[model samples]
Structures are given as C-alpha cells and as structure tokens.
Target: MTYCVGLSVDQGLIFMSDSRTNAGVDNISVVSKMKVWEVPGERFLCLLSAGNLATTQATISLLDERGLAPAERNPSILTQPSMFQTAKLVGETVKEVISYTTPAGQSADAMFSGSFILGGQIKGGKPRIFLIYPQGNFIEAGADNPFFQIGEHKYGRPIIIRTYDPKMSLEECAKLLLVSFDSTIRSNLSVGLPIDMQFYEADSLKAGYKRRFDKNDPYYQTISEGWSDALKSAFDALPPFER
Candidate 1:
C-alpha cells in the first residue's frame, strides 16, 4: 500500500507520494509513485499513483513509451490537447494494464486494481486536475473537492478538510501537505518513508520546487515532529465528548 495526495489551489498544484511497497511485513521495498513529464514552455504533467505496483509501473512505462496514443491500438496521454483528454488516455492505459493481467473476460474489478490523480497545464490553458479511474474514465476537481487523494487517504483527509482553502498561499499549501502526510505516516504501517513532493506554480511553463524527503532529512524531521506536537496540543484543548 501507499499514500499519495495532490492539492489544487488557485496558485497551482502540489503533489506528494511515499515510496513504500510491501508484499508482507518482511518483504518491504521502496519505489517512487510520482511520475513527472515536461515539455518546457509547452506543457507540464504530474501523476500520483496508488495500487498494485506492477500495474502502476506498467502504466507509467506505457505512458512514457507511447504518451497519448499507444501504437494506434492504445490511446495516448501526450497527444491529448487538454489535461482532460490526457486523463482519459491515462485511464485507458490503466484499463489496458488491468486487462493484460487478469483472466480473459473476467471483470477487472480486482480489489487492488487501479486509480491515479493526474494534474498539469498546457501552454495556452489554465491548470487542471483529474482523477482517472480503472475504467479509462475520469472526473476533474471541482470547487467542493479541490483535492484528490489515493492509497492511504483516510488518515490524512480530515486535516485537509479542516484546513484546505482555495485562497491560501502556496507556502501554506505546502505546510498543509506536510501535515497531511505526517498524519498518514503516524497511523499506517503500509505507507512508509522517503517521500517525493513536487510543486508547480501556475503558468511557470516548467516544473519547479521538487524535493525528496527521507528519514534523515532535517527539515522533514522538523515538520513531522512539529506537526505531531501541534496536533497533540490541539487535541488537548478540545472539549471532551465524554462526561
């Protein structure tokens, strides 16, 4: 399992995903779940994936190899003009991967199947965010749901629901993401350390402010520890529900 989150604010998009994959408690491994692509001034795309590791990696490789169209048989993400089209292409790719792995004619509704959050901007267009499903379809972020999360989402969602504001500064957005991920790390054993965070300022044309945070990173330590203490204090101050 993994935890990945993406925030869409007026300023732009912030995405992060942990690098943990495990078959069992004894067979844990690290693999990045974030995929980034850029065409400088032309376009920039970021993908956060959560599901079967094999399926996610296969879909990413397929995206890189054939982008928007996969050899005429599969749709491509690159050739799509809008982020919306690109998402469909990704969803198609995901569905194809699932088809390849499952028994012929069986429904691809495997419990640990597929899901992805796709966000990016085209040269002449405003930024957009899409949540692509296993069925090769998607839904964009709306005003009420300015964020999309996959994998170990529950542990961190409340923090986002309480603090997310469309008008917040990018700095605050970043801090909130840290707090969100920290919440997940504390509660889940499947979602482990070494996180990748990517921030894109709207209309920048190129991706900027990408960072990797692992166990030894000092600032990451500060953010994680500090947020924990803050949450504890806030809890202490809350009125009791039980008499």
Candidate 2:
C-alpha cells in the first residue's frame, strides 16, 4: 500500500507520497509514487499515485509517452488548456490502462485498480487539484474541501481535518503534512518512507520547493520525536475524569 496527499492553500499547493510497496512482509521495496511534469512558464503538474504499482506505473508511462510525442498522441497532458482538462485526460488514461490489464468481461479487480491526486496550474487558469478515481471520474478541490488524500489515508486524516486552513502559508502547509505523514508512519507498516514532497507557489507557473524525507533525515527526526512528546504533554494537561 501507499499514502499520498494533495493540499491547496492560499499561498499554493503541496503534494506528498510515501515510497514503500510490498507483496508480503518478506518482499518489500521502495519506489517513488510521485511524478511531475512541467512546461516552465506555461504549466506545472504534480501527480501522487496509490494502489496497484503495476497499474499506476503503466498509466503514468502511457501519459508520459503521449506527452513526449504530442503530435502523434493528439492531446498530450502538457497541452491541456486547463487543469480540469488535464485531470480528465489522466482519468481516461487510468481507465484505459486498467481495462487493458483486466481479463475480458471480468470487472477490473481491486488488484488492478489505482487512484491519483492530480494538482497543478495551466498558464491561463488558477491553480487547482483533483482526486481521480479508478472509474474515470474525479472531483475538484474547492473552498469547502481544500485537500485530498489517497491510499492508507485513514491513519493520517484526523490531523489534517483538525488543522487545515485555506489561509495557510505554503511552508506551514508543508509542516502540517509532515506531521500528518509522521502520524501515519508510526501507526502503519505498509506506509513506510522516504516521503516525497513538492510545493507549488500560487501563480508561480512553476515548481517550488521539493524534498524527500528518509528515516534518517534530521528535520523529520525532530518532528517525529517532538510530536510524540507534545502529544503526551497534551494528554497530561487534560482535566482528569472523575468516575
């Protein structure tokens, strides 16, 4: 399994994903689940994927191949005029890849399914983000819901829910997500790191900060340990319940 999140704040967008995939406890490996595409001043796209590794990789490869030769492939991801259209193209590609992999007449099984959190900005449009499902359908982030998370999401969702704010700065958003990711990592074995994170500043039309956090990263270590101690202190500060 994996964990990926796309958050939208007033300052910009943030994307993050864990890098562990395993067939069994004995067969574990690390592979990046993040893919990024850019056209300099024209557009910037970031994709965070979850679910079957084979399905996700194939879908991305097809998109990348088409993007590389847009003339022959027709509508390339890079050529989309808006973030909405780009998301639709990704959903279609995901559906096509899954359909081809599943046996004829048998519905696409869970083993062959994948999902994505797609976020970016097209030259003439404001930044946006979408959660694309396995059925070739998607929902965009908006005022009410400014973020999306996929794969092993439950373990890390509460923190985001309690603290997310539309007015958060890009750096604050990154810190919040790392705390969320740290919470998830402590509780789930399937979602191990090095975590990949990317930032896109509002109206920048280009990528912003990007980093990968491995188990030994100094900052990550600080956050992880600090959160644990903070949680204990918060618990102790609570009024005791008298039976």
Candidate 3:
C-alpha cells in the first residue's frame, strides 16, 4: 500500500506520495509511485498511483512511450492543449492497462486494482487536478474539494482538513503535505519513507520545486518526534474528565 495526495491550491498544485509497496507482510519494497512528465514551457504533468504495482508500472511505461493511440488527432499527454485532455489520456491508459492485465474469468474487482491522481498545467490554461478511479473515470478538484488522496487515506485526512486553506502559499502547501504525511507514516507500516514530493507554481508551465524525504532526514525526524511529544503534553495538560 501507499499514500498519495494532490492539493489544488491558489498558487498551483502540491503532490506527495509514500513509496512503499508490499505483496505480503514479508514481501515489501520501495517503488516510486509519483511520476513527472514535462515539456518546459508548454506542458507539465505528474501522476500519483496506488494499487497493484505491476499494473500501475505498465501504465506508466506505456505513457512514457508517447502516442500509443492510433488516432491522429487524439492529443497525447505532451501535446494536449489543456489539463483536461491530459487527464483523459491518462484515464484511457488506465483502462488499457487493466484490460491487458486482468485475467479471463476473474471478476473486475478480483482482477486489476489501481487509481491515480493527475495534476498539472498546459501553457494556455490554469493548473488543474483530477482523481482517476479504478474504473478509468475521474472527477476534478473543485472549490469545495481542493484535494484528492489514494491509498491509506483516512489516517491523514484530518490534518489536511484542519490545515488546508485554498489561498495558502505554495510553501505552506508543501508544509501541510509533510505534516499530513508524517501523521500517516506513524499510523501505518505499509506506508514507508523516502517520500517523493513536487510543487508546481500556477502558470509556470514548468516543474518548480521537487524533494524527497527519507527515514533519517534530520528535519523530518525533528518534526515527527516533536509532534508526538507535543500531542502527549497537550493531552496531559487537559483538565481531567469529570470523576
């Protein structure tokens, strides 16, 4: 399992994902779940994936090949005129990957499973965000819903709700994501470290800030330990319940 989130902020978009994937309790490994594709000033796209590792990898590989579609006018990710078109390309890719991997006679639920968070911008458009479902359809982030999450989402959602403000600056967006990720890591072993994060400033049409936070990173360590202590101290400082 993994934890991935994409935030639709005023400045642009913030994406972060944990890298851990496991076939069983003992069969665990780290694989990058976040992907980026760019064309300098024209287009920039990033994908955050969660579900069956093999299927997701296949989808990413296919997207990397460019123009797998037969239609001459079907704009590929790199050539799409808008972020919405880019999302349709990704959604179609998901459908293809699942079709190629799902075994005959197996139920859809039992066959392939995965989802993606697609966010980025094209030269003439504003940054946009979409959450693609296992069935190859999606919904975009809106004013009421400014973010999307995939895999092990429940544990970390509260932090987002409490701290998220659509108008917050890009740096604050990054900080909020890290705080939310920190909460997820402590609560679930399936979601491990060496997290991948990318921040895209609106209308930049170029990838701006990118980072990776690992297990031994000093600042991450401080945040984790300090937050734990602060929570315990707060609990203890609260007035005792009626007795």
lDDT of 3 by residue, 1-243 (tens): 789999988888999999999877698998999999888988889999999987788888777764454544333567777878778888898898888777554565444788999999888788899999878888999999999999999988997998799889988887778778899988898999989999999888889899899988887788788878987898999999996
Could you tell me every candidate's TM-score relative to the true structure?
0.89, 0.93, 0.90
Off by over 4 Å in 3: 66-75, 105-111, 233-240
Local error of candidate 3 at residue 99 (angstroms) = 1.4
Candidate 3: residue 54 lDDT (0-100): 78
lDDT of 1 by residue, 74-150 (tens): 32555678887788789988999987788655454445487999999988788888888887888899799999999
**For residue 163, what is the lDDT in candidate 3?**
79
Identify the leading candidate in terms of lDDT.
2
Q: How many clashes (backbone N, Cα, C below 3 Å) per candidate?
A: 6, 0, 0
Model 2 Cα lDDT, one tens digit per residue, 42-157: 99999999988888998998888854666665437888888999999999999998888897656643589899999999887999999999998999999999999999899889
Give the candidate order by descending lDDT: 2, 3, 1
Q: Which 10-residue span in candidate 1 carries the lowest summed lDDT? A: 67-76
What does the lDDT come to for candidate 2? 0.91
lDDT at 7 for candidate 3? 94
Off by over 4 Å in 2: 66-75, 104-110
